[model samples]
Target: MGEVKDVPLLSELLKDSPKNWGKWGADDEVGSLNYLTSLEVIRGVGMVRSGKVFTLQVPMGAPEGDPIWPGRRTAQRVNVMDHSHYQCGKGPHFPGELHYADDMMIMYLQGSTQYDALGHVWYDDQIYNGFEAETTTGGMTKASVLPIAEKGVVGRGVLIDMARYRLKNVLDRGETFDHEDLMAAAAQQGVEIKKHDILIIRTGFIGSFYTMPSDNFYDNFVEPGLTYSPELVSWFKDMEIPNLVTDTIANEVTIDPVSGIALPLHSALMRNLGVAFTEITILDELADDCAADGQWAFLYVAAPLKVVGGSGAPVNPVVIK
Candidate 1:
């Protein structure tokens, strides 16, 4: 429903206008933070203003590995035992040992490279934007992401069903996704993206993970895959998106048709800019509802384990309409 502008002409965007040698300067415009979004591709149209919060979490099973999109691993059945218990018959076989069975896992939170709350990941031994790392710890032990309590999370949420649009020949899922794709989807549904809004995408890849857990788990090449371009990243960063989420196993597209690498979105967002990502959500029900209601956006909330100094934490996000 929106206009296409020749794949955003990465060469130009990298330059300035993203085509004709940029706008006014730098031939090497690697990161200037200019942004643009059109409401042409409307998604989560109705849910954006919903009163209740939406849920976006999937049930946990045994730890599983995605043959495709390997940016993050999955929870599957595993042998867990708390070392503190009488394993070999002792006063204390092991302290802080495993207890919960495969029944629950702490893998979905910040999504793999999980988030280390302001209490975690410190810059120059400092936490968050300016909190000193020493202040977070007792006796100068210096805390990491572990101490992150539940209060650290709680915010508004929005979702875009990019996958659904493609199926109706509305959004282009066959081609690489760019910033405009988001706009186009929004416009088609008559929705607008606002500031500080957490954007979620449903790429249709969630099916295999849901319907055929065994096959989707083992097969490397499957349909409903999702991906994002650097242009999209620029837009989100410029928009200052606090959190990003997806219904698929991997937040980013698995295969890089151009570079043949895995997780271009994840690499660019995480290792590159440190944007928070959420994955493995049970969006099928939501997707179905979105299709029927023609609304995509919804209020979302997810709380992940406050693991310390860890790469990621496990979370169960909920989206409400």
Candidate 2:
């Protein structure tokens, strides 16, 4: 696409989009996640059959470095104390001569595979649940990741492997898909995406990031993902989806080809409908297994770190089959 100024504003594009604000109550922070009631938890647990488990987080500080959004740096792990300190006789002393290494990591809250708080993005000066955008000025005070972390996300997760469905190892950059494509992929996998299902879509985008040249991966800076449409947004609301997990930087196409707008779904579905977003997940292993066994539905469980007043939090979603 061209410069962002050439595109329609998100507020204009999503002005007619549906919203679930105040549906859960005025004090609500987590939006569509409210759909994951106890019954939804039980429905997720019932998807477990083979006892196989998959962790959907990529390495945080890999040798090749973690993948992050543009303009954000990779995680930097610093060793505050190590055996070298003891060797140099400058380490802290203990009564029993105990030795230990301590370290800390500096990274964006959304740098790793993570869940975005409902208040992470907004237009019109309002976030999910009508929280004022100013509430996120210094750090999120309302609708922060803390609330979502405390609530937790547990539900049946249905995997829709769009790459496999389309007979490709990975979709082309800037490519877009929608709810109709998702339904078609689910049908191809012989699974039904039910209400309150934690929808996980795989385009093989994030997986390819590791092997391809970083420059090439980010050259055009657009990601292949679901695009914005009123019908797509309505489908999410009508289906009562609780969360959307994907192996991409952003869950939606970076820029809408039609309106020339950028990540309009961030405004339509997340900011408006209050649907949670899980991004940059590692789904190759899970996608491979699902393709092999033809089992696409599973119990999905994830608990983001309880970072008080955070816009987003890192997470390692667990999937059980």
Candidate 3:
């Protein structure tokens, strides 16, 4: 209801991050609050508590197969140019200089398992829930996605290892995970559904998306367990979970018969219902930790890049044990 502003803002102080340096062109690297000025700031979003959470990358770094989508934008090697400061003299901005960096791998990130930002989807040109398509662009990072306070996703998380559920045993990489398989996985794990809970699906497709046929461009039919039926999407959107994450590239896959293309659930959830989604992330690292400790609920965190109207982001989420 207010307005996004670009007043003299305190610039960001860098800490030698190989990726994304150009924060105000180096002249403000003293970690001083001065550069914070003139940085185009917005703080409508409440203080993020996920500051203490964990992350599981699914569509991260072009996991395995052909990570491109309808646009055919092939995933380039993750390359970040300079990161240090390029001090060009001094000024009231204390540590003054241009904080610059090229070759920066910038991806608009979402919160947990890394779902699509509210700006990522829309139906017939309109954004999610009650957003207008024409007016949803170029927002400040802090104000990019829905405010952490408004629709912040802090809820119970359940993992359904569809592959294991279907095979009736632990699965190896590249195993097929279908809808029927997901149910079995839930039954085996004794996991139940509840309101406001985030669902983390494991199809064991992580490795494949990263190995073997490296350029396995997402095709509709014949793709293994990496996909699901359109009904699954409809069901999830209807269930109205806060969000749905996964240990795979995309949640539901290219079901030629189901949705007639790749990314079925994406359209169903994002375009239709505005359900946040995450791509590839690192989740299995804590699988045993979670199972051993019987910990399903975690203080999840997803701090995506504030790419201002960007599609998605690369995140380093941490889950507090």
Candidate 4:
């Protein structure tokens, strides 16, 4: 088989795709998140009926290890100081005989449930808002996650459980879905995907990662996700979706089957339409509750850590029904 570098470039695949560059302004780093105004927050609040809550972050340092992108490792937490240290007379002792435990984590910013910076992906030597890609050198001077973390994401969220809709516990590897499929799943759940809604899709992919053997899960790893197409790109533009949260590592298929390009939607949507992307989320609990209550819409609130110059930041998104 031919190598990945032989495929068409992302710029070529998304050549005519719609772009929201300078839509908010040249200085805007948060991109489509600007759609989440107070009015949208009010709209989100209206969806809270029973007041059940769900937190959508996967445990970092899980015993089974995290399901991360191939080249990256799971988060590793180390105890800087603990009871063991105190017992060994190695830990600092505060006045009044106070003792405390401390810890630190080593991880890729995108290792867990996280929000990707607008500058996370790009092509043609440019990032979102037409910022020169060179600005990303040394540490995201243009569209880092800091701006997004400060603004925050709060709005209506709709869950489209594609696995349940397709009568599968988990989608087959490389399975693909598109905008029409999303609408169909929403229709099945009796919900409408409105403008500025935080679109959260559950493929049951992450849930499988915990049960299946790690080697099997990573072998020929192609995640089932939204495929790239001009029409699908247009739909995202028309819908004005602020954020896309999914149970997969990459928000879309790892490699576009048709174009043989990797993550074309990252360019067509995030880098062009300026939509926010949240990946590696724990959505089974949220999806189960939504399925049980027949209520798919809810208030989605997330604040990624304000890591300056970070390409992305971990987030524990909260969903209120």
Candidate 5:
């Protein structure tokens, strides 16, 4: 919520932004999520004037097709009882009907709409708050996704709506925007990025994909996202925003310009800053609703699956205006 002033670029801030290793504590697991205090939740609740809810999750099997991520299988669902078995009264005991539809699913938790827990990424053999990498290989003993799932993420959610404001719903693949762009868009929308807010950026990626669904296109092609810049990281740290969700696979540009690291922003946020991220979120409906009503900030409610010791989990986040 501070004024936008000139500051060192990401490259410089990357060297200076102190690691939040022990800011919360050496044993801290939830990372920046600690920012979501009860008062913050109360602030979010007060924003819900219309009581309209918008779910921000893309379906588990999205685009009406095969899996988009390579090597990850599509979500599988199977009935526990077949038609023949159910008809023969082989199902569990019941008075009138002896049949029931019981089903199970085998899914890749991070395949669709998901949250990248603090344990999901690391750098220099360290995770958030200096947890070792070896411990995370088997399963994260520290900073596991369970804690986040158990303690729901609730706060004021703000949508940047970059696609509609800047690209006119035609964002190009591999295009990247930086901190200035984010601030400019927010200013244009008359929305301020508040502390401890769940910041959601709409790049129009998910919206575009729905129109032309292609596994190959999504899996291999470049995509538009926030540029992996130190300036952007600095802004996040300065703003104290806890969670970030975007309509892109990777929150940052696919290729880093300076270090050439594949996902430098992930390392900066998850590894260095303890900030959580959600990717491939469905934000078109939220964007449209915000544009129609001019209410950009609202109450955000998201609960990650309580997958014990898991790196990440699928999430269904809802925004209420």
Candidate 6:
């Protein structure tokens, strides 16, 4: 691929951003994910020279202090054996001869490190590919997260360690950065953004979660994330990035800098361009490994649960260098 040169600003791209509604096709459901072609997977495979792997998913049930989002439940595990008829030394088996344990969990699919499906966000009653925003109660016929889960996300992953480049423990809450900032971080790390790549940005926020009070971290702390700007969205579109992963709750700044719009990044990327997001990922270890080896590109892989009609699903993403 060639270097990205002189890309237009968000202001210039907004007019055409909406025009992308039918660019893939009227019946297209996989939006920007179309960029993750077989060629891209080949390129990703070529990046795995080190053979070291890093898991990007935070541990399940790790965020147990309080609910981050209202109505979103923390994961809970229960021993199902209690309810089972089979018991040790009972009717099903002889004493100490056979023992079995069963367990079950209830959780919000998007509660942890997860990908937001194309139907996860929308603008003014429309979803990706101009699908009308209507579905039967808790189910969806189109734009559900299942397509992504089925296809699986595989590509070259590039890490832009903003926290390390900026020399901050963590980017302060409410801090916003633009395209230039991202480019600078990539340049500083001797990496290049390529077409169809899964971009991972490290704010070092997830590391802070362990050191700070849960209440302070969730309630009082504003998060540092990408700026919700037309320029940033334009850059992603121009680069043909299929998916984004960030070590922050909201990929964009917590509070929208733009007036009247809440999550412009989500709207532009997910709703309009079909770009997916894996938010609240743990990237500190990956960033550290990249920095140590001086290699920022790796093979990224993620498989979401095949939840029918789900808007989003928790993901266990891995980066192999």
Q: Give per-residue CA lDDT, model 5, range 47-105, as digits (tens).
A: 99989989877776533753234467767776686666767867677798656567787
lDDT of 4 by residue, 5-32 (tens): 7788776777788999999998999999
The regions of model 1 sitting more than 4 angstroms off are: 1-53, 62-151, 168-175, 222-230
Cα-based TM-score, every candidate:
0.59, 0.98, 0.57, 0.98, 0.90, 0.89
Model 1, residue 313: displacement in angstroms? Answer: 1.3
* Global CA lDDT computed for model 2: 0.92
Candidate order by decreasing TM-score: 2, 4, 5, 6, 1, 3
Give, for candidate 5, the lowest lDDT window spanning 10 residues. Answer: 1-10
Residue pairs clashing in model 6 are 10-230, 173-222
User: How does model 3 fare in lDDT?
Assistant: 0.45
Tens-digit per-residue lDDT, 74-139, candidate 3: 444453434433344322233554454555433324322344564464444444443456655565
Across 1-321, the per-residue lDDT of candidate 2 in tens digits comes to 677677778878887889999899999999999999999999999999999999999889776778889999988899999999999999999999999999999999999999998999999899998989999999899999998999999999999999999999999989889999999999989999998999999999999998888877888788999998899999999999989999998998988889988788888888899999999999999999998998999999999999999999999999999
The lDDT values for all models are 0.49, 0.92, 0.45, 0.92, 0.79, 0.78
**Residue 140, model 5, lDDT:** 75
lDDT of 6 at 142: 81
Tens digits of lDDT, candidate 6, 237-265: 89888898899876877656554344567
Clashes of 2: 0
Q: Please give the TM-score that candidate 5 achieves against the real structure.
A: 0.90
Ranked by TM-score, the better of candidates 1 and 3 is 1
TM-score of 4: 0.98
State the displacement of the C-alpha of residue 25, model 1, in Å, after optimal TM-score superposition. 28
